[model samples]
Structure formats: structure tokens, C-alpha cells
Target: MYTLILISTMTNLSEIRALVLPYYEDVALICAIITALPVLVGIILYLSKNHISKPSTPKDAEALVEYKKYFTEKELEKLEVPYVQRIENNIERDVIEEAADFLKSSEQVLIICGESGIGKTKLAIEISIKINESKELTGNFKFKGNCLFANLRHYKNPKDIEEKLNAKLSEKTVLIFDDYQYNMEVFNEIKNKALRRNSKLIITTRPIFVKALKEKIGEVSIRKIKLGRMDINGILKDLEDGDLKKVERISEGNPAIALLALDYIREDPDRNAKEVFQGIRTSKDFFDKIIKDFQKEYGEDFIEFLAEGELTGGVANIPQEYEKTMIEMEKSGHIAKHESKYHLTPDVLSEYLINREFFSGTILKHSFEELARADNGTYILEMLNSIMKIKDDREIYRKAAAKLLEIVDQLEPNAEQKKKRIKTGIMVYDGFGSLNLVTEKLKEFWTDYDILQDGKDLLDLGIFLIKISKPYEARKCLEKAEEIFSKNHDKVGISSTSHSLGIIYQQQGNYEEAVKKYNQSLEMKEELGDKSGIAITLYQLGNIHYSQGNYEEAVKKYNQSLEMNKKPGDKSGIAKTLHQLGMIHHDKGNYEEAVKKYNQSLEIKEELGDKSGIAITLHQLGNIHYSQGNYEEAVKKYNQSLKIKEELGDKSGIAKTLHQLDRIKKDMDRLKEKMGEENFEKAYQKIESNNK
Candidate 1:
């Protein structure tokens, strides 16, 4: 058996050798082929690099032509202004820098998300300019390419855009799509092509569109850089200090709006910044397009609900049926959710919606009382102010203003609701600029309700009356409020009412009564430990002393008020005190000291956007120039003050300035009489030369 097994094993071994020996030549050949394969690939790659034709770069003129197709002449002009860099706090990264980094990476797509007018397109343009200039941004790759821009809406159809993109895009090329919306077929095709060609795409769109874009471009290497509103100080940094404050208030950190404001100023160089801002129609088309798109996607009722929510202090109460819709709206960036409540996003949108509702009469369908009782009544006032800006809508605004006041009489005066009624009435009068309507409403309210019972309401109305320069009406309200407060033993109400009365008396030139009211208010404020109230009373007392021609006493009171104001950082109070001090110095013939004080006050008022205060200070400066016989300088300052007063509709202030101008003319005539015509002409020339 062992012999047979050995013989079989040997036979098997012999068969295996016989099978392997014939293929030895073939095995050697396979090994040689494997060893040379890498060398063959290297040779092929080198030959391909040298032989293939490179993409032709367009000349600068041709590039400009292509860019013009995407940007308007006006938009191109805007590029002359350097782009302000925006930084992201969370990542501590410059948005432009991050975008450049993304362009250099393997990421094929970058979506820049922001609200309308938040500078997304401008940022994208800046990023494109950066990438086009810097070869380092492309890792110093040999395939230098152009940066192209297109707004998707500019094309007649998606197919047109797709064809253009396919024809233009190449390796290392950067393409920007401004105001991009997702089209699944077009985007998917372009995305695949971009990946294959090693190109990059940058998309600028409202935040609402980003989610849809992400979903449509599935598995594509994409990054997102969200933009927020520009910093308040960053927008138009070189604007005059007063104009800067106006722009900051009106733009609300929106860089596009800020730029629009700058354009308005350029167009009307002589207008007050406040007037220019009031007349600037924020891109109605942009806001209208957003609303239309939202309505189309979410239905009219849903859009209305969001708008109404915004009008009512930004808290939307979603029902069970609208829960999914609300979530989708939040995802689409039409609304934001906080603590289980949804709010319409981008306050400008809310303002637009309110305006739309006002025009459609949808807002008027709700009683003014009901609207006023909503979480924020200020929206109603803001809406009225917006309407008042439209020159053609004056009649309609007056009608609406009347209707608002009429509704105030209907409001019930329960504890919680009474406060709303008083606030609504004051806001309506303050914002609408209709004194007759307010006066009628006040008379009706006083007759219908027991004014003596609501001391706080009377006090509030009196203060608002004083602000509007209605001294007679303010005196009536304050006296009534003081009587009620005394009867009720409400020291805070008494103090506020006394302070308000002091303001009215001082305005009326009744210095003795003004001092008495101020003392009463000051004593009560001290007892109540109201530091801010005491500062205000001291300032008022200083005004009384100044009017009485007691400069020394006025300075003492003003210094006391100034010290108190500084401790609490009450800039407005400090500014008022400084202005009074300047007036005293001016009367004492201390021109230099007076100018210094007035300028300090003016700076603070400009920073605060206090047009009324600014006008007053400017008028005082004009007085100093007049006293110094600098006729040209005085007229310049007076006209500057007059322009602001006119813009503010301060009739009394305007009258005062016009009177000063008349006095300046008379003074010039008197000089002409004292000095003969030729001598007067020579003197005027000399003054002009000195001024130069």
C-alpha cells in the first residue's frame, strides 16, 4: 500500500510540473508588462500636457462686456467704492477670505446666504474680484481662468442659462450666480460638469433658497457662507457725523440700504440727511418680489398670517393645521422660530408687509383699538409714518390719520387697556402730524372719560404736548394731571406733571412760574431717589435762570445738571445743559468760549440724530457769527439751521431763522449807509478774501 501511495504522489508531482513548465515564457512576459505599465502612463500624461490646446483667455475689454451683461451701469459704477469687509464672529473668519479659500479647495459650489439688501451680491462680486486677481487662490495652477457672473433671472429660460454655463465654464473657472434659485435638472447637470472640469460655482441668494439648493445639488461638495447685516459703523464710514447717524437709523445695518442712502445724498446734495432718508424709497421691487414669491409658495393666507404676526410684536400663534407649513416657512427663512413662537424675519420685510396690508385695507379691517392692544402698537405708528412719506398719498394718509384718532375714543379705559389707549393716542398724534385731529380727539376723550382719575395718562399727554410745542394745551393737561396726582397722593405722577409744567412755562417766557414748577418737581424727584428725573429738573431750572438773564445762576444750575447727567451717562441731558451754557457765554460776549460749548453740544446732538436740538445749536452758532459781524458765515450757518428746521416742519424754528436772516440784511444795509457803495463793496471783498 505504501509503495502504491508513493508512486501516485510522484505521478501527481510530475503532472503539476508538466502543466506549469509550458507557461513559464508567458509568466515572464506578464512580469515585464507589469513593470513597464507606470512608465507608459507617465509618458502618455506628459505628451497630453504638451499637445492639448489651452483655453483662450478673453481680453480685459471682452471681460468687461461679459460683466456688463450681468451688472447694470449703475451697479458697475457702485464697484468704484471699495467693498467693506464683513467678518463672521463664530468662525473668526473674513467672509471674503473664506470664500476665496473655498474657491481654492475641492469644493465645487459655495452658496452665500443672506436677507434681501444684506450685501450678498456685493460680497460675491468682491470675492470674484479677489479670485480673478490672485493666482495663489488657485494653488498656482497652470489653468488660469476668468471669473464670470450671471443673474439666473436675466436669462429667458433655465435652458438658456444652462447652455451659457456649459459653453463658458472650464477648468479653474469661477462662475457666480446672483439671486440663484434651484432648478433640479439645470443645477444637477451644471454641478456634475463643474466637478468633472474642476471648476467652481458661487451662488448668492436669499436664505430662503439655500435649503432647496442644497437638496437639489445632492452629494456635490458644497459649502455655505451666510451673511448678516453689515456693522452699523461700517456702512458709509466717511459720511458727515450727523448724516452717519441718520443712515445708521434708516439702514438698520443693511449695507445695500446704506448705499442707497448714499446715492440719495449724492443726488440731492443740499437736502438735510433726514429729509433725504425720508424720501428714499427702499427698493419696492425687491420687497414686492419677495412677498410675491412667498405668497406663491405658501399661499396668500399663510403670508398674511406671517405679516399679521409681525405687526403684532413678531409672535405668530400657529394652529395645528399650519404647524408643518410654519416649520417649512421657518426653514425657507420667511420666518424665525424662538421659544416655540414664529416671527417674520428681516424687519424691513415686516415693514413692507404692513404697508401692503394698509393699502389693501386688510389692516383697516381690524379695529384700531384691537391693533393698538396687540403686543406692539408701534407698528401702527410706523406704518402711518411710512405712508406719510409718499407725496401722492397725503390725502389718504390724512384720512387714515383721522380714522385712527376716531378709534382712540372707542378704546375702553380698564387698567391694562388704559395705558394702551394713552400710548396709542400719543403715538397717533406724534406720528401723523395732524394737530386738529389730535385736538378734537383730546377734547372728546377729556369729556367722555374722567381725566381727573387717570393722572398718569394726563401726565403722559402733557409731556407729548410739550414735545410737539403746544404750550397752551400742555399747560392745561399738566395742571389737570397735577391736581389729580395731588388728590391721589401719587408723588411720581406729581413729579412728572410738575416737570412737564415747568417746560411749558419756560417755553412761554414765564420764568417765575417755570422756576416754581421745576423746584416742586426737583423736591419730589429727590424724595423718590430719581437721579435721572433730578438731572432733568436741574436742566429745566437752568433754562429758567438763563431766560431771567441770571447768567451766573444759570451756569451753576447747568454745571450741577451736567455733573448729574455724566454719572448716569445721559448724553441727551448733557447736550441740553451744554447748549444752555453756550447761550449764557454768547450773551456775555465770550465768543470763543461760546463756540466751543456749542460745538460740543452740536456733536452730541448730531450723534443722537436730534434734529430739533441740532437746529437750535446751529441757530446759536449763527448768532455768534452775527455778533462777530461775519455776515457771510452767519448767513451760511443760519441757512443750514433753516434747512433742517424746514425738513423737520418746525414752523416756529423756521420763523426764527428767517427773522435772523432779515436782521442780517438790515445790518448789511446799515453798513452800506455808514460806508459809501464803493467802500462797502471793497469791505465785502476784503471779508470774502479773509474768509477764503
Candidate 2:
């Protein structure tokens, strides 16, 4: 039996040991001595090979056949990454993260649902990348065969699904099904196959699919995530003023449409709103070009209609001659009508549709005049609402919107009017969609920034910039803002500035300054009955102390935050504070206490759907395994953390994993050397030098 095993296998140490153990007692001392030298020498040879051998890391990866079998040369080249590509995803960062957490730890099955253009594709990609990281980190990234990324709408039927899954389904692999909303039975049958075979199954769809699943498979069979539109805040903050204007001019906030719009902006950097709108259509036809396409379709009618409709009837109304063209345009997705009027579809679909009028509209000057002359607060609000919809010349909207706010505020004839204007201004601010407005407004606070108001504008701009993470500018803005607030006796603005400055310092690792600013903010909030503000400041102080390694002091500050009269979000803040305490315990080598604190944080994070926070805890738990010399378990935890990081595109966490992986490899080499290798010393030296 041993001989048969030996003939079939290159080497089976356990079989050899089993065969030899039975014969050891019968051997003569001289015979044993004579045989021992050769056996010892063979053991040394085997150990030496295991200890010194490296994994299949290629010199020029392009030469690697194994890699070529599964990936394109481009994929294998391991594209140079400068930093995490900043993706302003349409879906909320938190929702995607929560779904990812379940995908990493659960049974490799998930369903993500959202409306079209709501970022289902992005979320799927995020989850897949993360799982890929997990496979890579654990030294198990073999895809067995290939990866099949498909839009399920075109490919339905259980048989087709099986054929595709069989085409690539291996022991270790993942499949991403995008736009999988059209067929419910095909999806379930595919999911069932992956489950039976124990492989990863990811499905992306619109919300309609969830209903189909519920009706066909019953509640017990459905496990899914629902997605929403791009938060205006996320979109705005992601773009610079120039890009923000471009996005507004093109996509608005729809992820798919936004991409289409961005491409056009790249091609025609100088195109105006009317010119852009002219080209914005989804159908690929004569109407695709801005100036010529629509003209060919509608002839002189399209032009005379635009001249009469936009120039004469005002944007609030449309001319009668273009009414039929407008319906056709709407059906083709060239023009969008919301409240009995026409506006250009977002920039994404603009290339497919033509809106030469919208693309050519004089946005910077003329758009502002139309807005200013528009009737009461409600009418102005309606016009402001249309700013994001118009797309293609966003700077026009920003300057115009800011001016309108200033103009309306100045015209405040009574107390009620002032309140209405302020409310309308905030609506415009929020509706302009994102941080570019805040950043633009705050530009007046720059070294050479010029705004007529000496201090009020700067103070408001400072607060706005702080919310958007423009720290460098925030500091300058806030400093001037504080001086102005002090001059005008604006106690509220002063307090706010103090609070914001403290957060800036704390984030930069300046604990001393952070604490000082918090103290002043705390005093002001207290006098003003700002209980919520007090709690938030206390929490910031706690984080600063924690970063400085002051565990006890952090706990004290956290307790103060807890003592204040705050709201639901504060509960998550408290959980974070507890998490910081867990780290301190983990660092101090109190494994049990650390685990307890971590478990507590995990519960809160789960409840809160805080995926980033959960990933952090997973990373911390991995340390416990390394501390105990349980390398396999340690690698497992690290792999789990890597999966979450990948889904979230958390770059810092990826870097940390790479740094720690060197240790795991070295440890494995050391164990092999200790077995019997005479060249163990040389192997250790090679690994050490390689690490350096």
C-alpha cells in the first residue's frame, strides 16, 4: 500500500512515516545507524527545498502561462495605482458597505436592487473587488477557469445560467450578474447551483426584480439590498467647481447619465448650456449631434420653435409649434418634462439626444437675469430647482444662485420676508447639489478672495467648507470668519468657528490645539443651550485624546458626550468611543477585554449599518491571532478585513495588509527550515533581506 502510494505521489511524508513506524522496533542498532545517515540527509534536502522555495512570482509577469490562462496581459500587469481612485458613487457609501459585510461573511449569496442609474453596477464591482482581495490575501486566488460578467436581461433561462456557471465555476471564484432584473426563475436557479457547489453568487438588479422574487420564490428565498439615488452632497463634494459645473450641465445626479455627460464635456470643453442640451439625447439617431442632427429631423421647424419657445416664451413656457416635437423628444429622452414644461435630459443621455438650444443658452448672464426677474420666493425657488436639471454650464448656476441669495436677502422688506428668503436660499444651496457651491462661496475667504461683505459671507463660507473637508481653506476662512463674527457681535458664528477649528486640529493629530478649541466651543454651546452641540464637541475631544494614546482621558471625555442631551446619531458616536477603548485594551495585551469591547462595537455597527466601522474591528481582531502565533487564523481574519476594505475601496487598509503579509510568509519559511534543513540560516537571511 505504501509503495503504491509512493508510486502515485511525488512525496507523501505521512505515508512514509506510517510505513516506517511499524519497522522501527525490529531493526538492529548497527543497521539503524547505517540507515539513519541517508534518511537524515534526505530529510535535510526536503526541508531545505521547502524553506528556500518562493511562490510562483514571475520576473516578467507577461511570461507567466498560469496568469495568461485566466487574465489578459493588461490585467496581469497589475496596473500602477497612485491612490484610491476617488469614485463619487450614486449609492450611499453606507448602504453598499452593509451589503458588502454580509457578502464577505455570509454564505456567498446576495441580491442588490435599485432603480436604473442608481449605482447597482458600482456596488457589484465594489463587492467583487473586495472578495478578490480576500482570495489574494489568503493565497487562494485561483479562479479555476474564468470570470463571467454579464447583463442578465439578455441572458435568461436556467439552462443558459448553468452553461455560463459551468463555463467558469471552480473551487474558488466569483460571478457578478449585472442588470439581473428581467428573469426571476433564472436568477434563483443560478443562485441554487452556486449554493450547491459552494461558490460566490452576486446579483444586481432594479427594484422591480425584488417584487418578482417575492412573488415567485416566497419571502424565505429572498435576500437582497435596495439602493437609492446619488446624494446631492456626495456628488457635489466629489467635483471641483469646474467639474461640478460640468456635471450639472450634463448628468445631474444619475450615475449612468453622468458618465455620458462627462465624455461630452471632455470632448467639448467650451460648449455652452444650449449647445450641450442640443446634443443631449439617449437614442442614437439624427438627433445625436447638437447643431445638425435635430435640424435634419425637424428642418426649419426645430429652429423657429427654439427661437419662439426659449427666447420668446421664456423657459417657464414652451411655444405651440414645438409641442409635438417636444413629445417626440421626450419619448426619445432628449427632453425631459417634469411640471408641464421642457428641460434637457441630464448630460449622460445628451449625446444620444440633441438640445442645441439648451447647450447654447447663455447661462452665466442670461440665466441669472431670468432667475432674478422671476416672481415671488416660490417662483425663484422653482427656477433654482431647475438649475441641476439644465446641466452643462454649472458655474453659471453657482454664481447666479449665490447672487440670487444675496439679492433676495438684501431685499428683505420685513421679518417674514427675511425668513422666507433665508429658507429659499438654503433650498437653492441644497438644490445646487453638492459641495462645489460651498467651496465656491467660501472662495471669497481665500488670501486674495474678494467679496463685498467684510465678514458675514466669510463666516458662512467657512462653516460650509468645514462640512465638506476643505480643511486648508477652512482654516483661513474660519480665521477671517471669526474676526468678522467678533466685530459684528455674532456670538453664534464665533461658537461655531471654535467648534469647527477644534475638529480640524484633532483630525491633523494636534491634540493640544484640538482640546483648546473644544473647550471654547463647549463654553459657548453651554451658554446658548446647545446641548447637541456640546455632546458632539465632547466626542471630538475624546477622539483627540484617543489618538494621542490617552485611553483614560478619552473615556472621560466620551462619558461627558454621553451625559449631554443628544440624538440618535450620537449613539453611533458613543459606539465609536467604545471602539477606541477596545483598541487601547488590545494594545495593552488584554485580549479578553479587547474582544468584549470589540463585540460591543460590532453589535452597534451592525445595527447602524456602519460597514467601515465593522471593517476596522475585523482588522483589530486579526491582531489577536498574530499575537497567539496562530498564523492560519490570523491570515483568515486579515483576509476577512481585506474583503471589506476591497468592497469599500479602502486603500489605507489594503496597504496595511500588504505590510503585514511579509511577516506571514517569513514565518512559514522559518517553520519549514526548523524541520531539518541545514541551510535554514541562509533561507532566513534571504527572507529578511527581501523584506527590507
Candidate 3:
């Protein structure tokens, strides 16, 4: 019985094990699938990101190995630095990609241009390296050129460069002419031979010197990349946690300069932004070093020619004595050849050299002496004309005027240069707002010289004298001018002199005399078809009429003046007319019309940067607001007018604005008492809410 029970229990245990075995297998399979799913997904993602694929052929493996060879491990490491790695705004990246694509598409010449210290060289190196490493590339790629200034001097001509480049460009080579000064000879030789379909030439240079290449090669097939301030922001990224912005602000969009400035700031944390910028601007170290090196190799005279050559045009007109020096300097990267001329590298260096020469007075004195001797007058006149063109500071104009006067004093009494010199001096003094000095200088010359007998000269002097409020003295000169004009039958001269006399009479309150002279001038101007002169006479007549309360006549005259000025695109004349029209409307109590006219005048004046005119219009606008019971708005406009007046040093305008402000304050106090503080605010709220 016990044997039978043990056999039965064994049978039951064996059946239980058989039933659970299948379920155990299912649980293990499910666990294994859950564990493998993440690993499979991760592998797929990695492959997708890296574009990894198994090589199907031996050539594929070889190509991969070759692509990796373009950048050595050491070079790859260098790119990790922010200076190399950081690319701001993708400007450099887009350029690099465009260049690479061009090179691949068989574009022969790629010119990269920018101001110096703007990272042209680095960008070029980056481009070359990227091209070499491209997977699509096919050839024994070689990027070889002597971009060093020292090495560049050895290349006397394009033939010398081509000879050296010939071997490297055997299998799709890139010849890098870093900061190349392309002359017609060099460009022609390379364009024919080295710049073939199989090989490419990459040139880096400043923007100022690229005109020559463009002129020679024609803009058809040339590919150009301009590195700009936006590109230099790459340095900002590499700046990491330091004062990158400070360095960038100091650099003024120059990468190399920013790097130098960063190093400078790191050396002494105490240095401020102003000091750093000043140091960068004032530092002649870059050019000084180059000059010193050249001086040692060549001589002091060679450097002097380099200095003078840059100042006065270029190497073409330089004395034959410095021909070899010019060539050497061009090779040495101190100067670049463009447009059949030689310009200094890094334009700012040229500016610094010019300023240095100007202050030294040697070159300036020599030029002055030459002008005095030649009596050609054009050069000196051009120099003075440039001062006016640029609208230089009063101090600069004063100094220039003084120097020109000294030159004039040294010139021959009846020399043409002396005449031009006086004319230039008067122009400069007039611009400087020192017309009294002009009067003094002209009077001094007139007392000593016999130039006043000339009708045109007397008329010019008379008009200028009247402008400076010397109407009494101007009358004598005008009478003389009229006499000469009458004898010569110069209708144009008579009209101009008569108009000037009318101005004097009008200012002296002789309304009838002024009207008669103006009408006479207008008749002659009409006969001569001088639209400009007619417009001037009409404006004067308008002013006289307005002063005498003839509003309708004034409006008509101003409208005619406006039409004449519009034909000539005389923005200032249009603004003046609009301003006068606004004044007339204001006097007539047409506040809305007056405001529109004043605003139109203000827009034109602001566009022209006519600060004085802007202030006047703002003042008028303030008056309109004050009349409209908008005291707060009036104060705001008055303040704006006053601020501009202070900036312009217009004492009269300032006084007027201040008086308006005082009157507005008193009006506000009275209004406050009459309406109470709350009521006054409510009234201001309504005015403010009104869109005028």
C-alpha cells in the first residue's frame, strides 16, 4: 500500500512540473525582448546621426582613410579653440561652403576680401582644410603657397610664383596667394597658366585693393567673399566667460585686433575699454615693425618713399629712384598694387601714416611751397575743398585756414595761387562761422592788393559782408559792383548785386527801396531765365510782405519760391518755404494747418540733419500746442527744441525756448488756480488723448 502511494505522488509532481515549464519560457522571452529593444533603437539612432554605413568595396574604405588624412590629429585639435572653432552668424560657414562648392565646380580664382585684422587668412586656411577633407573630393589634394611676408618678397613676379606652384598643383592643387597685390602682369600670367581648370588660386586682400583685380579679370567668372564685422563675432563665442563683449567693442569688428586686445586685457585687468581702444587705434607697432624690418633690409629712403608714395596717389607717379623699393614693398605686403596704382595694406595704417605726415608739417610745408611755386592753385584749392566737403571741425578748419593764409602770404602778389588762396580762406571762414575773420583777411588783402577793382570780386565780397551784418560796408562794394556790371553790360552780375543790395535795404527797414531793388533784380533774373535767382528774389519779397502784414502776398510769393526750389531739388529751400508758410498760418490762427506745415518742414530738416532748422520748427510746433491749451505737450516740445538749440550752441534759440517754458509754467500755475489740480490733469488727459 505505501509503495503504491509514493508512485502516485511522484506521478502528480511530474505532471505539475510539465504544466509550469511552458509559462516560465514565455516570461523569459518577454524579459529578453524588453532589454533588447532600447539597444536596437539606440544603434539605429547613432547610425542615423553619424550617417554610418558599412563599406561595400575596398575603394570606399580607402576614400574614408584619405579624407581623414586631410586634417592631422594636431590640426583637428587646434580647431577646438574658440578662435578656430567659433563661427559667429554662420557668415564664415556660408563663405567656406560657397568657396568649397566653387572649387569643386572648377572655379579658378576665389578672392577673399576684408579690412585688415578681419580674419581673411584664417578663413582661407579654414576653406583650404575643409576642401581637402571633403568626401566628394577626388584628386591628390595639395594646398601650398608662401603667404608669409618674408616669402612673398622672394616672388618678384607671377612667373616666380608659378614656377614654385607648378609642382604642388600637379594633382588638383590650390595655390594660396594670401594678401596678394595683383598687377596686370601677375594676374594675366596666372589667369592663363596656373589658374587652369585643374588648379585653383585663392587670394586674400583688403577691400580697397580689389578694384584692380575686378578691372583686369572682369566680373564674369570671379568669386569673391567679403569678411565683415558680423563674421568676426566668432571671437565672441571663444571668449568663453571672459570680457568677450568688452574686447569686441574695443576691436571695432576686427578679429585679429580683438585677439590682440584680449591678450592685452588679460595681462592687466585694470585696463578700461577706452584705454584698450585708444591703444589699438594709436598702436603703430604693426606697421612700425614691418617698416623697421624693411628699413634693415632696404634703407631709410625706401621707407620714406613708402610713406610718401601712399600719401600722394601711388607707385606710378613716384620718383624713379624708388621703383625697386616700390616693388619690394608690394612684395613685402606693406603695399598692394591695384588699378595701376599702389595702396598701403590695411587702409587704417595708411590713414595713420597720413595723419603722422600731416602733423609733422614736413610734407605739408613742401606741398605748400610747391603750390606757391607752381601757382597752379588746383591742388591747394582741392585740399581746401575737401575740408569743406567733409565739414571738418572748427579747430581743423581754423588751422587749415591759417596755414593757407601763410602760404598765400608767401606767394607772389599777383599769383593765381594767392587769388585761389583768398577765395578758399573766405569759404572756410564762412563755414566756420567766423565771417568777421574773413572780412578782416579780405580787407587786409584789399588794402595791399588791387583786386577790389574787379566787379565780380567786389560783388562776392559785398554779398559776404551783407551776410555777416555789415550792410553799410556792403553798400560801397555793391555800388562799385553795379558800376562795373553796368560798364560791362553783365546783366547776370547786375541782378546778383541788385539782389544783395535789396537784402541790405530790407534788413535796414527801408521797405520801399528794398521792394524796388528786388523787383529790378527779379526782372533781370526773369529775362536771363535764372530760376535760382528768381526764387531768391521772390523769397525776399515774401519776407518783406510778411513783415508789412501782407499775408496773402507773402503766401503767393512763398508758393512761387516753393515751385522753383522743387524743380532744383533744393531741400533746404523747400524747408524754408514750408517754415514760412507755417508761420503765416500760425499768425492767421489756423493751428491745424500751421501744425501740418511745421511738421512737414521738420521732416525735411531732420532728413537733411539741419539741426538749426529742426529746432526752429520744433519751437513753432510748441507754439501751436501752447495756443491749443496743451500746456504739458507744449513744455515737451519746448524742451525738445531747447535741447537741440543747446547742442547747436544757438544762444538765441535757447533764450527763446527758455522764455516759452517760463511763460508755459506761469500759464500752468494760473490754469491750476482756475480749474484746480484735478481739473487741470483731466484737461491735459483730453489733450494728450487727442491725436494731433
Clashes per candidate, residues 3 or more apart or on different chains: 0, 30, 0
* TM-score, model 2 to reference: 0.36
In candidate 1 the C-alpha lDDT for residue 491 amounts to 96
Residue 279 lDDT, candidate 2, scale 0-100:
53
Off by over 4 Å in 1: 1-302, 312-316, 320-351, 354-357, 360-425, 432-452, 465-476, 504-516, 567-569, 647-649, 674-692
Q: Supply candidate 1's per-residue lDDT for 665.
A: 68
Which sequence of candidate numbers ranks them by lDDT, best first?
Answer: 1, 3, 2
How high is the CA lDDT of each candidate model? Answer: 0.62, 0.53, 0.61
Model 3: per-residue Cα lDDT over 8-86, one tens digit each: 0000122224434666686576557658786566666565468744222222211112212333364345333443443
Candidate 2 per-residue lDDT, tens place, 367-401, comes to 43453545544345544554434333223445546
Tell me each candidate's TM-score: 0.52, 0.36, 0.48
Off by over 4 Å in 2: 1-472, 507-510, 563-572, 599-618, 621-654, 661-692
**Candidate 1 C-alpha error for residue 103, in Å:** 28
